[model samples]
Target chain A: MKWIDAPWIELLRIALEVAATVAFALSGVMMAARKRFDAVGVCVVAFVSAFGGGTLRDLLLDQRPFFWVRHTEFVWGILLLSLAAMLFMRQRHFQPTERAMLLPDAIGLGLFAAVGVDIATAVGMPALIAVMMGVTTGVFGGVLRDVLCNEVPQAFSDHRPYALCAFAGGWADVALRQVEGTVVSPLLACVLITAGLRGLALWRNWELPAWRV
Target chain B: MKWIDAPWIELLRIALEVAATVAFALSGVMMAARKRFDAVGVCVVAFVSAFGGGTLRDLLLDQRPFFWVRHTEFVWGILLLSLAAMLFMRQRHFQPTERAMLLPDAIGLGLFAAVGVDIATAVGMPALIAVMMGVTTGVFGGVLRDVLCNEVPQAFSDHRPYALCAFAGGWADVALRQVEGTVVSPLLACVLITAGLRGLALWRNWELPAWRV
Candidate 1:
């Protein structure tokens, strides 16, 4: 049996997921170039940022050959994109501006959360764990990327509610599934909730509580 | 019920695992200092090197609280070690020559592999997956650490059979159990096989097939 529902709806989720992964992957590649990291370094950041969350989900869920293992295309997709981005960086025309990348970054974050909730639902994870998984999968890639770059992860920073935003959206997603009581398609409900709250978070400039030492 | 035949044996395992984790965590701290990574970077690398395998295993098994979560003391132990190493590095004389660090590094590799295999066996994953988990846990911390340090992991290098040696020892441990039946303690078998093979590999020098392109 196919795990995904409504081919078109699934496609919508995947399209945005791929977009977000590409966007996040590009961010890492750019950072690598700035750091003068070698070819392997560039690939490491790109791969970890793009695949870390899904890899964790698969590992936790015991889903294997792993998503990347089976779908070499996704790996290739990132490689091709990384190459293009690297080339563009060599020229000045297509230089990636960090400011311009935020939209895709937020969209990717929301899309990944939706995917996480959907996967958790299919696997029968409890609601809280599911929400946590969603948020972790959504934000952990960037967190890992930042930590690897020898900087504090924005997710852990108090300046912005990076992980908090993902967590809120994930909680909303799970809550919607429960309150709707099988009336709503869980996938659509998740997608809508994650995307909506993420948008609200960005627009409102949400911040989480933190104290500097 | 207590899982092991004798209390002393179990205590030995716990003691050894703690020592291995501490040693590995210190190695990570040393690497971070050599590169001048920040305090957050030190903590992250220490955590990953010490807990990365168990975390990955628990996540795959969907086990709650994770290993470190169950043994919060483990993190406390590693943290204390990291702090000591960092303070020591400020005034201590150390050179990260691969030649000098090889012995403890190899010992840690084997010990971690044994722990990983033992955990996977308890969780009842496939034997192959369990062996792979042992290897993954043993080497992946260094891989993550090296990547964070902006260097290529020696695992992917033509330099040596780093992961291959761990995989061999882990499989030997598992295979020995199948031959000896349940008479011998599996944990003991695991530790013996891992330490023996890993020690020999490092002492005599071993390498695995690598693709250079």
Candidate 2:
């Protein structure tokens, strides 16, 4: 908590949040484009992807004035990003692909997980619940994007270790928090471990065990 | 707000809410069964359908201790209902069908819409936003159910006027609130109008114009 009071740390947190939001928004934009959605639909998808996870976490935690609402600039930023993405893709004749979204999606997942865990822990939520919130924050946005696109959530069905990475990262955060006087920021540790694990999973093509039923 | 303070009104409201929740949960149970989901999946879907819309509304309004959390009985009730449903369906050799879900879904929509509007208005939200909350509460649970089942939400993709019924009902509630010394309960009016409209739509096979693009 004291670490968060440092101006530089607060700035870093905001910067990471913005980066994660943009990454998630881009993934939504790509999904919408692939689905042949119109302009408004594309923007809606982007907004949902950017805000859905944190919104859900806030709701569960009973927080007021949602993160996006408190920071209206996020709304404007996503809008401009969505518009730019559409125009840029059209001009370049870019074919949006799932593979193109992987990196950004992974990065967003890690950052969001870190933020979600931090917020939940700040509110005195138990470690298990905090970890779940982290996983929810990291994975729910993409799940929503896929759902809106009328597909089973890739996080649930793709057999890729998406949420599991967030789960591990959340635990890493809890472990770090328990250690006294560690210079390593728990948030940074979470993001690195999560994104790195996800990267390796993709590189090695790891898969979770699918339900047999 | 004074009207809501009446003990009888409070009792009636709780009764309607319980009915609505069960109806929504039943619809979810049927859908999950149709999809051949396991017991855990069926219960999850039922819980989501029963609480998803209200949860979203609570989040939007920044309400604490979500409806389901505040009323632990609702959670237990849904758990029992889900188990009972699976057993009964199996014993009866009953095939779960979309048609079987219509009546319960419509009733749930009407009741949830009324409750959502009441809650929003109680919080001093503007009429338009309150009405939107009503529509959201009526429609979002089913949307989430469909999404979890990996289909486009029928509320959006189906040609039927589902949310439109809630929209009209919301406006009716708004209009009634403006009337001086009305004997009729606005909640009852909203429910009757919404459910009646939905029933008519189903009977007449009414369709909304599809997007051509």
Kindly list the per-residue Cα lDDT of model 1 for residues A28-64, writing each as its tens digit: 7866665555444566578778888877776777666
Q: In candidate 2, how many Å is residue B74 off? A: 6.6
| Per-model TM-score on C-alpha atoms | 0.55, 0.61
Error of 2 at B10 (Å): 5.9
Residue lDDT tens for model 2, B130-183: 999999898999888888989668899889999999999998998898894531
Ten-residue segment with the worst summed lDDT in candidate 1 chain A?
A181-190
- In every candidate, how many clashes are there? 3, 0
For model 2, state the Cα shift of residue B24 in Å.
2.8
Model 1: interface root-mean-square deviation in Å = 8.8
lDDT string for model 2 (A26-141, tens) is: 99999999999999999999999999899878879977799888899999999999999999999999999889999999999999999899888788776766886898798888
Writing each residue's lDDT as its tens digit, candidate 1 over B1-213 gives 244446775576677678778767876887777788888889888888777766666665556887677779888887777877777767667665566556777778888888778777666666766776787677777877777677655554433556666777788778876776552356556656666766776666664322111
Q: Number of the top candidate by lDDT?
A: 2
Segments of candidate 1 deviating more than 4 angstroms = A1-13, A93-96, A179-189, A210-213, B1-141, B145-213
DockQ of 1: 0.07
